[model samples]
Target: MDRVDLLPPPADAVAHRADAYAAAPLLNSLLREVAERLPEPGDRPVYRLPGGRLLRVRGERRPAEPEVRTAGGWRRVNHTELVKLVAEELTRHTGLSNHDLPAEMLDSRDAVAALLAARDRATAPGDPYLRSEQCLVTGHPHHPAPKARGGGPVAAWLPYAPEAHARFPLVLLGLREDAVVEEGDTAALDALGDAPPGYRLLPAHPWQLDLVSCAAAFEDGRLIRLGTTPFDVWPTAAIRTVYAPANDLFLKFSLDVRITNDIRRLWRHDLLKLRRTDEAVASAFAASPGGAVWLSDRGYRTAGFAFEELAVLVRDGLRDHVRPGATPLLAAALVEGFEGSPLDTLEDPAAWWEAYLRAVVPPVLAAFADHGVVLEAHLQNTLVAVTDDGMPVQALFRDAEGVKLLADVPRAQGWERLVYCLVVNHLWEIAAALAERRPGFEPWPAARRELARHDLPEIRALLTSPTLPGKTNLLLRWTGADGAAARYLPLPNPLAGA
Candidate 1:
């Protein structure tokens, strides 16, 4: 019975994968909706994706695929364009626009022409991860030869190619921790396999030598190779490390002392910040009609420190706003304000605030209320992507470490400190920045009205609906005027049901 079950999936597992296939089209539909809603571009070239989705271009031009619509969808013109398009799309999606183009496709007109001709016959659809020949990397990852034996660690590092490549896709190459391998121990090194049809690994950079680690090896149901922990190289920092088998994520780790000074000073008082963000997102979606527009594949988290993952902005962010002469105002705003740079000083304050309120705040306030919660929607933490014409297209709320829900607290006083953070600190900062351009710009009434539109229904229904998870009390202590000794409002324990 065990062999029979192990030989093939239990049918139910296969059915679940089949469900994933069935659900993909719906995800494609959401991508289509977001594409359609993109503000019209002024002058930049817009490239169409597989499902009629579009992206606005920016910066230096790289080669792109020449595609024509077919009965099925967009088909590539030649192999060169096919490969070029995949690289460009990945570069754009990952915000790694500055990478140099691979040399194979450069300097040869005949090669380019041949590639264009071969595109359609060579590429295929349904490979969302771009597993086709179009995305093959031709070079090996840059890695140094095995370190000198003896004096350093107790063991020798060795490399072996795997029989099946994808099974060990994350084979790491690098330095070992303080402890070295023993002479008799089996050496651990990255193993490569026979090249698949169109893919190759790029070599590691010399500068990355400091970031290297020993490869971990595994076989059967247990580990055959044990590598040193990453903490060995960079110790004393509170690191937030995340791995997505597919999507690229951002990691920020600093020494514990640094985190204590940077984040904990202000936020340590708020233990429930993480819980509040999750609860607020859940409540907001619960209140929506069909449901809120959220990322099923992405969000924020904290292990020793805070971190965000699978940033949707990396793929769909600001792509449409990269037009000539148009600065991405929101990214510009954060980069400027936080970085202490300002956009051309807006001489007209009213014009700037009008744009801020209309473009930035209303949509966020509306969405927050629609979800039956409040957001720590501040300028430093919020990114607004606007069209070339200075129209706001999307607002990305970040730093879940700062999010709080109104329903999670009781009494005006309990919620006051948070409201101050949202309204006085966050919103006012943007307002003040806008005021730099337009002296008379005031957004108080407009903002209040917009927020009230969302908040009133919940305020009215509160008595009928039991109070939500009281997760904000822990977060409130941070902003209270009193020191850590301040009295904290007792909240009903949420785990009581457990």
Candidate 2:
């Protein structure tokens, strides 16, 4: 055993991560929705909430080390105190009582502390792409408790944490051939490894296996172990979806943990409609110009007995869609940052921003207008491939699960959802990151130009709308609503008149 483990933990580690973890979403919600900025006092940004409650934070990006006005004035608020402060202010500001979100806030803080500790001891992946995928410590710019791992004990989920740079082999199983329920091209699964004559190969995420109860399946001869994979797979930002570099394939699993607003499970309803949804987006990309590709959810395989629990989704890997010389990087990592992120040492912010807009915006607009396909082109679902000099070469999108066809939703509703996902959630966040790094640089003009190029009627309104829809994640989690049933509040539109 390590001597450091024997020594009963340090105070600084816990407090530092907790403050950082707790501050971001609270600051995001407070500033974006409730608080009004009261000119910068020195270097720090200060805000005045309802009833003149003044709050200030140390920095931008992942705002840390919060301080608030008190009887003594300008006293530092710890994580616990911060949670109380958020609850109090929100209650008064929104005319609502949310007892649950406060707990999730604390849970998020505690979870961050756990991740930080685990990362300290863990070894990072050798592959830079994998490193980028795992680099998101502060995920979901506007989400409260983005790192909250279902409020479970540390050991229960720590090993599966992408933030900790964890990479482990999949738990391979042999489900009887009769029990295999599948859709689309699952041939890649067969190529993963061999299965016995009577059985079919089904690779499972180890963490998911641990969470699920499967003794009956194992005992009834429906499922049997066929040993683990020879090589390890890197878990992406979406913890349940892992990349196997050796096979050049992606496998998504059903995890029960609540990541952001929803329990990360591959739902049965989604599984049933996967082919239709993926085909629509795939056809859209096929027709669209600008080298934008769709990383299709090619197929899914699951056991009939434990359908959802055993379900595994197979998606197109980076090898297939990524341009020959260019490297594909997670769009979220471009915002969150990784070692080799093009966003980190951007030589020319304007050129970079334009290239980014060219890559991400066109296909999305084309898909919506031409094919009536609404893609959830949020940061996590989009991948931008860059050239040798870090200029974006291509944009590849994934996750058919979130696609909403215009035939299903009203045209107005689909457009609203598209604008929120593509512009507010994806583009605006990246723009803010670039702006922070290169002061006096604005990213919205180029963004506006890109949208105007689409010639869609929605683009005209999008440019003029005083407010953009921002997802109300904190409120959603507090109200205990379904994740797909997204509710939005208006955010001051930076795109307007830029």
lDDT of 2 at 246: 88
lDDT of 2 by residue, 1-498 (tens): 001121224767555655665577667866666678888648988989876888888776656667987898788887788788878887786778887678778888887777778778887776667877888877787887788888778888888889988888998899999999999999998887789999999999988998899899899989999999999888899999999998889899999888888888999999999999999999999987789999999999999988998899999988878889998888998887777878777799999999999999999999999999999999999989999889998999999999999989999999989989998899988998899889999889999888888789888888999999988876676567888788888888998969
Quality of model 1 by C-alpha lDDT: 0.30
- Put down candidate 1 lDDT per residue, 39-71, tens digits, no spaces: 545553444653454543321111122344466
Candidate with top TM-score is: 2
Best by lDDT: 2
Whole-model lDDT values for every prediction: 0.30, 0.85
The TM-score values for the models, in the order shown, are 0.35, 0.94
* Model 2: pairs clashing at backbone N, Cα or C within 3 Å: none
